[model samples]
Target chain A: MSENRPLILVTNDDGINAPGIRALIEVMNTLGDVMVVAPDSPQSGMGHAITINDTLYCNSINVIKDAPHKEYSCSGTPVDCVKIAVNEILKRKPDLCVSGINHGSNSSINVIYSGTMSAAVEAGTQGIPSIGFSLLDYSLEADFGPSKKFVKAIAQQTLKNGLPKGVVLNVNIPKLNASEINGIKICRQANAHWEEKFDKRTNPVGRDYYWLSGEFVNDDEGEDTDEWALRNGYVSVVPVQFDLTAYRAMDELNSWELK
Target chain B: MSENRPLILVTNDDGINAPGIRALIEVMNTLGDVMVVAPDSPQSGMGHAITINDTLYCNSINVIKDAPHKEYSCSGTPVDCVKIAVNEILKRKPDLCVSGINHGSNSSINVIYSGTMSAAVEAGTQGIPSIGFSLLDYSLEADFGPSKKFVKAIAQQTLKNGLPKGVVLNVNIPKLNASEINGIKICRQANAHWEEKFDKRTNPVGRDYYWLSGEFVNDDEGEDTDEWALRNGYVSVVPVQFDLTAYRAMDELNSWELK
Candidate 1:
């Protein structure tokens, strides 16, 4: 409730103690009063899932020693973190909300299945300026150092200029050093999807089980796409929306014969 | 795979034993050689979540004795069923995929949080023509008789004319009887959201936990919306897509001073 500074709500899908979030927190410390409400455990690929059928547990935590920001860990998905933060944790509406600096890429089609971006979209649904940041690297020791400046720049600019209603940013940083990064490019999500090939195996109990795996396929050759931007060593910023409606197809659907 | 009939994949967010999926199964059986792959447990509100961190169990189950279709119950989210069905269960790609005669409404913004629609979208992502159908009535005993004809018509139409890649239909039916139903309308998703209010309660150990509750708010007055169509006793069909990109906002985002 600082009068001079903006209140920023921070969250991520990689759990409260992930290195990606710590890097995000360090950058947000320079911007405003930050409140982090994240999952107690990693919630990757959870999409926009919420804890409707289950009870939610959210508690204050001090993960970072002497950290300036207030933090809470919740027993829920990334979207649940935002819902609880906005409804139960924060007293007043936050001026901004940012998710991730995620452990891996949320670029292109991954945005549909990303827990990191889902947190951001949830915040955006609640009428807050929100952004989700991700790196192309998937390793736990992935270099988040190069992402700091772009993260700060995007966050600062978002704070300065509010996002339009129903829209949030999905920013994917390429795995390049700060000097090598070719700045930010506002782009469209590339038309892409995972060609899922489930790894099927038999358990010790003689029962079949499946582990979901997939190869990323980007058939979109548009140079003005997130995939293209990331491939060219640029930080791609795609404005994403919660509305699933394909407005362009409405007319085509109307042409169908249905009495 | 018979050349005389189209192959159909039937799934639901509600468990395989739910009356909703059974009704969906009965309807799809009339359309083609149906393969029923649904969650063994109710997965309402699971969104586009996939079981990544956990093992998924799918087994052959005979919920409907001697039913003309092959059925399997999976211990996974609705999206997981689609992945497993396509990758491991089905010998060939399904000609059409239909998800849910869901026990509840997935109209408007609910489409984003719907496991039903997510299942259909997952199918769509895999290049299968798909549709997710729901009735406004959430009761287990809610009559799906009114929706059967419409559902058959829609599925038949989809099988005849394949859906554009990445797009699926999100169909919500009014609770009215088939005779009272006002037919179908191709509509846009209404601009609406859940005004969430968490119900806070203390456990036996005096630890506070919260249950999510929300009021559905539809402020959109557009008559061309799914909400308005459903409210007017019509079956509403909104063409939904997996691409989260806000194409219209790309130009405005491109104008941001990021470099």
Candidate 2:
């Protein structure tokens, strides 16, 4: 709504210091007045966790040298960063809120466990136009050059056209180089799951512990799915909503006739 | 799918020691071979979170004295409990997975931040029939007696006729006694949100910190909502799904025509 460049709030689950967020900050610097309020530590799978039982600490930081954007580091989850940014930090609600450029994919069922997408969803819940971006690669030094144009295009388009109510974009970029990329595809979330294979190990003190490991399984054969789009070398954009109600099944449930 | 007693996986975000899960366990014991796998500590706002970067420990515990049900206390989030229960503990997939009888409500927008509902959603993702139950009361000593019959009936119905794929239930019982309570109503999640007020305070060391405090704001006046049903003394049952995809927005997004 700004006559000047729109005020964009930038954040991520990989912490303010992560290269993923830095790449995002670089992109937003060209777009608008950016203010980043992100977690001080990596909060990869924190989901929609807030600092209820504990206290939150948000401190101003310089994530990039002579950065155009002002930044703050928060001592909470990605969702907490968005809450504190909206309620306490910013003087006004931001024109747009974009989370991530995350180190790993938040496609398909990963969106549920994603701290990145949760931040975006939190922003959407607060009635802000928001988007979450993630790369298929988990490497810290993954190539982000190919994603720059697409990311900016998406953000620019969102700013111009505006997002629908109760909806946010979950954009996942493939790891392919710029030349190998096949452009963006707006798609639905695939019916996929993580086949959890917990690595059970015994501690030196005789205590047994397990580390969560998993293999991504895309069971949905639909060509219109985010999984299919990502697999086919395109950046996948799936519009996500926070309303969990399964309206399609409500009639069936009503048929139960519970007393 | 068992020809004998159906296998039920019972879990809660309030940890294994909480009274809510105990009430849930008691109800499930009468209906099936109940196996309780819950968090070792309270994980109220851990929505869809799993322990990825850290280690998890799941230990057998006896919460109820002379209990018929088998229970395991997991050192992870509520979603982790479900993952561990399904993968590491149970020999076969559970017939039904029930999470919570939560001390507090998981109604409307609260479901997005709820660890209890996250467990149920996780089960739903794995193609299991799941339900998350909560009471409007937040007290540890709140009477769960009023909820027992309704909870049993719903669970019985779910067992008799399985939930559709990717669908789960979010059931919130009102605070009234059993006789005072009206019948269950299948409803939609109300468009509601918390009006967050962060209590900013200086720590003993003089640095500032904030505690998240909020009041539930129900702006939606729709009578068909869960909020309406709960406020009118009826138990609200909302069939929830894990498909976050906003299918309605796909066409508009496809029009973007990114280069």
Candidate 3:
């Protein structure tokens, strides 16, 4: 942005060795000087967690041999990697920060619980223009072909236009081939909730234990929603902000007699 | 609205045995039928994380002496506690959910990383009227004396006047004596972030590690903000929403040439 090749910081929640971050690194390399500091293990549902209770471990890795990028693997949540990168790893604030080309969908209400989006949100809070990309596919071998070009274009657009202050992008690509995919659509987060069903089981000692499993239930059918766009074969791009303030509810709260 | 006493869910990020939750439990007991399912250990900065990768362990615990409320100690994040309560523990969806009389401030940017607020946000997603309470003091012996009446009044008001759809409250009390404290002021989350200063340390074996630490820096001077209210000796109440979508920026994103 300052007439220099933009310093782009890359990271993700699916761990450093995931194919998704590999794809992201390649795309980021084509865009600018790239530096990646990502988690060492998969952290899918980590949300906006930071490593405050425990010590964090970070080590340099040679993931892409001879590639013109510096990458490190940190034993922390996605949000932690971003903090470590900006505060301890990077020489200066990055011009842009991109998180994920995630292994699964992070659309709808999933954004709140997504470590992918949380990394981007963390960067946005620190004045970096940021975006988190996800594909509807959830497998290790999922194809990132269709999403690469779109990811490049979005990153380029963000670099050129700059994002709105306090906003980051949540881009979800539908699980479809390049040709079958309709372009990208700017949309809002569709309202949704997980119908949680804990799979109860007994340990070897006969104590009860549980595994959390949930079915995503979409409650909003609005056409202008991330869920709708992805379902209709479009890569949905939702601008997300970290300011959780519900300004509209302030008046009603103020009306209460608190004296 | 129902003839039966309102079924109230109480939870916090500070573990099941924290004095803050104990204070909250005492207040909620006066207004409704309370059930508490909280983390067995402190989960202060856990955010909205869930227990997905690991098996969850939840066991009923007698937290208070001859207390009428049923309590469970959960080995999970605060968000997990809410899910377990709603989907497994509680007989039905709760009428109201209240999280924390947290030991520290969750005002401004801290809300994004707050386990207390995350518990409340999880309940709001379930269509339950919810509120999170925090005190400006961060101490094991922090006085919740001044906050009890306010906490009761707010929770009572939430039971009486259901919160706006998709919204929950983030209430923070100033650390002052009840007589010295000003009243409550409904406000918005102040624009701010932790100016991160990672206290990097080397382990006994000479490996690099970090303990996350930071100072709360207030960048917003708005009089109608949580920081301002807290600074002025008033308990700040900020209405929080889980919808990460930045609706105002949708128009700008739409103009991007993503094709």
Q: Best candidate per DockQ, number?
A: 3
Please state every model's RMSD to the true fold in angstroms.
Answer: 1.1, 1.5, 1.6
lDDT at position A88, candidate 3:
95
Per-residue CA lDDT of model 3 for A80-198, tens digit only, reads 99999999989989989999999999999899889999999999999999999998999999999888999999999999999999999999999999999988899999999999999
Report how far residue A247 has shifted in candidate 1, in Å. Answer: 1.4
| Cα shift from native, residue A29, model 3 (Å) | 0.6
lDDT of 2 by residue, A143-207 (tens): 88888998999999999999988999999999998989998998999999988898999999999
Q: What lDDT score goes with residue B208 in model 2?
A: 93
User: In candidate 3, residue A152 scores what lDDT?
Assistant: 96
Off by over 4 Å in 3: A1-3, B1-3
Chain B TM-score, model 1, reads: 0.98
Clashes of each: 0, 0, 0
Q: Write the per-residue lDDT of candidate 1 for residues A1-259, one digit (tens) a residue.
A: 4777989999999999899999999999999999999999999989989899889999999887888899999999999999999988898899999999899999988898899999998888889999999998989999899899999989998999888779999999999888999889989889888888888899998988888888989999999999999999999999999888888787777788886
**What is the DockQ (computed on Cα atoms) for candidate 2?**
0.84
Chain A TM-scores, per candidate, are: 0.98, 0.98, 0.97
**Per-residue error at B219 for model 2, in Å?**
2.2
DockQ of each: 0.82, 0.84, 0.85
